[model samples]
Target: MFDIARQHLKTPRDLLRFAMSRFTEAGLFFGHGTDNAWDEAAYLIAHTLHLPIDRFDALLDARLLPSELNDALDILERRVSERVPAAYLTREAWLAGHDFYIDERVIVPRSFIAELLPDGLSPWIEHPELVHRALDLCTGSGCLAILLADAYPDAEVDAVDLSTDALDVATLNIERYGLEQRVTPIESDLWAGVAGNRYDLIVSNPPYVDAESVAALPDEYLKEPELALGSGEDGLDATRAILEQATHFLNPFGVLVVEIGHNRDVLEALYPALTFTWLDTSGGDGFVFLLTREDLVTGGL
Candidate 1:
């Protein structure tokens, strides 16, 4: 019993480490994402100590109380047994290298846009300097909205989302990133709230997952809000809405960079008569496309 207790309390640099010896007994126990079972355990333990994961190493030198250990295991057990996202359990997520508060109030942070933000998306934007006005549509967690503000320090950004719940999360992210002034968190349904407003860039990681795809996603995805994941069966309803309204809201030199994920082929097929540039990356091809206002008006897309 002493060995078991000590093992569960072991930490790399003095932080608590819970054993995974009992996780399998709790569920279908497929070990689907079990390689990081220790990570899940640490997350729960770290939270109880009011320390971030990075701080755990230094803070672990202090001893954990019995109650903290017991409470952590209880949360970790629930996570493994239920296949709930650790972010949902922790009420936070890290995106674009920043930590943001989150909850069931919003979807977990996941976006191809994050890949493009860090390096200025050199290949996609010819004149990144000209990106003065930008918009982050369906800004669920406001992750993209905040990232853009940080990337374009000189530019003011707008974050629009239909859900007040999501906007609330976005609000926290905006405030956390100190982008409250630069990034406006608006509760608007797509273009409705920004009527007649034109931007140099409109970026969106919208709800493009079709019903079938959403249903097929990993159990971790089951924890997110359905509104943030699903589009119509074809998955183009939201895309079409954005594309149709985007051109009217873009400057002559502006471009709409949107992420379609695996539905790129479907989009390409639907627009068989037109053309789009799909971005290639080390991981895989993204469904991101840069559409210009002139191209939309000229049917040159």
Candidate 2:
């Protein structure tokens, strides 16, 4: 198998095609930063060669030197043999066109909430300019926190996570973006460490995968930290904690947005009376909901 892969893999495009074929045959999952084998292969090949991923079309036919080809083959072999997500293998992940360093220490940033940040949480947030404070709970890579900062330039953002290693990665990214003054990384289990601190907008892409779902996830997902995926039986343990305390931390008229993924049904059943305004994204139903302080306090549907 290895001999066959190496024989036909001559140019960067050839290697990418071979990698994509192997990836498809292995039934690899592509939730982290990519949605298909072709894109993932292109990302690995482009980044490995230190070429621009966006400019891959022009460089696809470019042949790699012997040493570079060897490096590419080694990475592809590990990707298949180890069943690791391409992001972990490459040590980088992109969200909203911005790159962030990643490793086993943190979950690869792939939050759907990122797609909604540009509109300034419109309709839900009547006055975007009034959003002075924001919070990002379970901020695995601080991607959302950084996006929050970019979306709300005047807002001071606080990103919280329980994993020290994840926080380290987040800290690096915060500094990389030169957002040290605007974004603060906090090591906390949910909102524990940041209690009493309130925010006008609180966003989270928490651990919402149920035990069974976690167990059934592809090997690629298993490569990520379990703490960043599994929550509880209903996949709402962390989410419940956030909802229970989010009200207290949200200022008047403040809104809380969360991504529950496929666990939306369970969340609705758990809190049937509360009306959840599911947000729409380009990819369709984002499974993210918005709730205002008044909605939480008044139990208004």
Candidate 3:
């Protein structure tokens, strides 16, 4: 197939156009068709052949060794064949302005918590005593955990994920940022693994995608862990459990902030009297809210 590059592949962009046309012609769903196909194909090519992006762009359809060229084409064509995500194949994804490793092990970090951190959490953390301890529950790629640690340099941040494979991904991210001393990656099922840990600031972007939604998601999502996406039919299976136990695990003036996502309306309608400060931020509208211990004990406090 190395000889296929010389099969008049045309320009770099044209190659992607050709790839997209072929995938579509085959009636394959290579994601939402949002990203460029040949570009993605190029990424796979560059990765396999160990070529820089610029070099690949400048030398489109350039001759390659039989082995290297076959490898590149195989990777590109496999994505169309498997319907798996390019991110899963590449093991990299960007969130909150940084790239993190990803795979079939954990759910891709798409949590809107990125919008809640940095300058956003400041207003919600008004309590003078709420600065000491913090937790990043259900931390996937350690994305939230790293951000939390970076945000609260004065505080210790605990990052927890249920799957050991997921935790390993988180560990790679932590060490990649030289955060070995700050971010603590703990393997736990929500709060089950924490023995004597209560936090002044507890944030979780747990699995809230409902069963129907899970099944309805695009094929690429199936590459992630099912346990990390859907939490029963109503989707709050984990959230409900988290709400019931989170208060006891919070400091007196502490806060429990969970990202309920687009299902915010359902949660609000179900539990009306709770005091949840729905955060508005730069990234987008949020399902994340700050609920203090008092707020949790009292309605949604």
Candidate 4:
């Protein structure tokens, strides 16, 4: 198949079409960064050609050089055979219009919390400049921590993770964004490393995939670190820990925003007394929830 591609797939359009067909035929999963074969193919192809990924229309008919063609086919073949997320192949993930370096060390950055950052957690945060401290638990590649630094310029954002390898990637991204002084990468089990630190805002996109779902995850998802995906049985272990201990880590009027995946019902059922203000994202409101320090202390989770 690759030989045939090499012989016939000369242009970006030919490669794009061939890739989409191959990806679809392979029954590949598309949850990481892209959700369709077209976008995935375009991204891998664009990256292969060293062209702009988002502006592929101009490059479609342009023929790739011999070397670029080989690289494009190689990456496409890997995407089919390896079943790893494309971000793992390309070592890049974009969230909220910002690119972050990513690898198998961390799950691809697809946090609904990312959608909230641009508005600076408006109304709830009230003033982004007033935010002096922020925390991103399960920081993964420190994507959110970098975003937090961008969102709240005055805030010192701490990016915490259990995996040193993940923290290492986060540190690279922090340096990439030139946020080294503002975003501190800490290796800890959630809030363990930052116990004494209080924050005006805390954001997390923790491991929330349930046991059943994790077992049935696609090969692409399986390629990611399991520790970054599954929590306890109901997928609420990390979320529960965050809720129970968040109030102590937050300032008197601080707010907590979390992306719980599909566990809103499970989380709400577990803590019925807590009034979770579901935040709206492109995926919908149920995936993320917000709570104030008052709500946490009052609900007594």
Best lDDT goes to which candidate?
A: 4
Candidate 3, which ten residues in sequence have the lowest lDDT sum? 26-35
lDDT of 2 by residue, 222-285 (tens): 8889999999898899988988887889999799999988877788888877878888866666
| lDDT against the true structure, each candidate | 0.74, 0.87, 0.75, 0.90
Model 1 earns a TM-score of: 0.83
lDDT, candidate 3, at 274: 80
Give lDDT: candidate 1, residue 142. 91
lDDT string, candidate 1, 241-266, tens digits: 98777778998887788888678878
Which clashing pairs does model 1 show?
Answer: 14-60
Per-residue C-alpha lDDT of model 4 across residues 202-249, encoded as one tens digit per residue: 999999999999999989988989999999899999999999999889
Error of 2 at 146 (Å): 0.6
Best by TM-score: 4
Candidate 4 accuracy as lDDT: 0.90
User: Which wins on lDDT, candidate 1 or candidate 2?
Assistant: 2
Return the clash pairs for model 2, or none.
none
Residue range with the least summed lDDT across 10 consecutive positions in model 4: 118-127
